[model samples]
Target: MFATVAFAQANDDLTINTPPSIVQCKTTMISWDGGVSPFDLVRISISLSMHNTETPNLLLSINLRAKCSVTEEGVVVEDFPNILPGSSFDFFVDFPAGATLGFTVTDNNGDKAETAPVTVQESDESTCLSD
Candidate 1:
């Protein structure tokens, strides 16, 4: 059927704006929301290098542990899961509270398509700690 073909075509198309390139913390938050159909599986990955070399060293690897949730307060939440295209997800990491974070995204074909960096900030510190 023509309609079925069209649907498939549309669903195959996926697009998203990469997150920041440098984040500043151990717990970095990443989010993406674009695709023709709900993403079957979405993941946030990282490639670390010490001096920004052509090939950074492999420091660590991980996948989202649950589904991402968007809160009314504009905060994106994620437990980690296989995301569907045309949908969105969010997750946080456990980097230092003030360390820079970098990451990339890959599609179904194991292709690193996009990269984003963000600066991490301290969640909140008690005034007493300042002393």
Candidate 2:
């Protein structure tokens, strides 16, 4: 029973999802969360797979953006350039407090694939004077 519980805990922490793609499919934006700083580091992850008959070449890429308000528009914060096939990358961007954060990933062919958005809020335990 102990072994089973441990296995379950591990499995719960794991993320299982299909890859993101341009020609074949849209990329999957994993998660976006704020950290403990005035300029918090927001992490973004993406997976890509190009397996369509039209584009046989497997290519992947990821990028991130941010906004002041969740209801307002967002601007590109960080560009990850390119991510090759069978590989994944994670990046962080400094987001101001109370700002809305957004992310988007594109394929090697320069196509907008996936997007993830999150609103930044003051952490309960944050010690910073400014939110």
* lDDT winner: 1
- For candidate 1, write residues 20-72 as lDDT tens digits: 44233233335443334323333332333333342222333333454433222
Query: What's each prediction's TM-score?
Result: 0.41, 0.33
Among all candidates shown, the one with the greatest TM-score: 1
Off by over 4 Å in 2: 1-73, 124-131
Q: What stretches of model 1 exceed 4 Å from their correct place?
A: 1-13, 19-29, 33-81, 107-112, 125-131
Candidate 2 local lDDT, 91-111, one digit each (tens): 322322333334554433333
What is the C-alpha local distance difference test score of candidate 1?
0.39
Report residue 44 deviation for candidate 1 (angstroms): 6.0
RMSD of 1: 10.3
Candidate 1 contains a number of clashing pairs equal to 36
